[model samples]
Target: MLFADDPGFPGLPDDFIQRGPAGIEAAAAALEHGKPIADIQQFACLPPFRRAGKILCVGLNFAAHAKEAGMATPDYPTVFARFNSGLVGHGQPLIRPRSSDQFDYESELAFIIGRRARYVSEESALDHVAGYSILNDGSIRDVQLRTPQWTIGKNFDGTGGFGPDFITADELPPGCEGLRMQGRHNGDVVQDTSLSDMIFGVKKLVAILSAAMTLEPGDVVATGTPSGVGLSFKPPRFLKPGDIFEVEIEKIGVLRNPVVAEA
Candidate 1:
């Protein structure tokens, strides 16, 4: 069930996305009562929420990625936070910050939390997930590797571009292992990997995170990206001004952005 956040009813036009949790339930209940649902394709895809309370992300969750970067797999998830200001629409532009020598991409699968959770068990952690979306956790490589802290490199404004729309939990197939995550710049593939390579997976990350901090409804958690980033390429294939970034995930969808210098 796709839920769009369009605020107006607008005569229930075909494909009109139902807004709000109540609106989504009402639409489902209406279908049970034999009422029509606006055509699926007619509804415009909207972000899972206007703004998430927190955007938490995991680092080096993929074994291959750790190996590629010559770091040992973390004994525990390496967590970090990104400011909401970094967020951009799925099709939006990613304005590169000035004074940064290197910019790179990290394609990740991000999930939304539906309920407030604290110290949840790993076995039951997935129950809190509302849905999934595609997120490009774009980073500034030079700054990230320069300091022990990765935040300054990964959380710049317009770096967290995501969403064509959210794919509700019920709608997505279980066992995310085989999902394909690919990134391209100017029509050339740069990063390609499978979700199966993730070392921690969603369950463990969520359980561990919730145990440390409360995860509220609409909160976001990105599972981490695989290897093949520009930083890893020979001579380093960093993004330049006016470059197009296209990130695609098999089911969740694709998010495309153009690179531009900060104004």
Candidate 2:
């Protein structure tokens, strides 16, 4: 589906589906004749894609992140799921649940699937990607570590920060390689690294994931964060109410949010 705000196209629906290659072509054509939307930063941005079938996430995909966590790099990606309910848009508040004060930030690149594919090979995996965006996989550390499974802590309402904009795959280098990414707390840089540093790049991740199940359109795959998460610090530095966090990717733009206490 596509959401556009071109003044010339006065009757354009706020939400609509654009299917397959033809739909993409039509959207591109419309964009060529449309005027740019203004003052977007003042609006509450939604996740770049809505109604995502699955929100697949990878953990420790960066070697530095693994090292900082005192773990060996796994031969396979460590995958998890974050439901849509956990996601909040750019400029929205990320609630720190009252149960824990260990809220942490993880800066990640999120890829949205454009087409359905199963058993796809790494070489052709890029064909299935619609675009890329930013994600802050916020976690409540104490709860996340209480059990081997990380879902509970990771799935708390309003923990995930997504969007700002979705940049088409064609606008970026294939598989988004070599791009720089960083996580900033308030105004200070906390996590920074090159996308190339990821142990499992986009293509490899898609191939591996598709091998197990069909990747459907609008599904989101978060490539994982770098080192410098709160847990890796000498004294853990968890997020607190009034704190602001930003996740920036070289070309995809920034996903920013403010921390707030869960009411």
Candidate 1 ranges with C-alpha deviation above 4 Å: 1-24, 27-48
For candidate 2, lDDT tens digit of each residue in 18-92?
375455556666666765676556677777665788899999899989999888998999999999999999999
RMSD of each: 5.0, 2.7
Best by TM-score: 2
Backbone clashes in each candidate structure, one number apiece? 2, 0
- Evaluated at residue 18, the lDDT of candidate 1 is 24
TM-score per candidate, chains pooled: 0.84, 0.92
Winning model by lDDT: 2
Model 1 TM-score is 0.84
On residues 4-62, what C-alpha lDDT tens digit does candidate 1 reach at each position?
34333321211213243444455455545453545433433334454677889899988
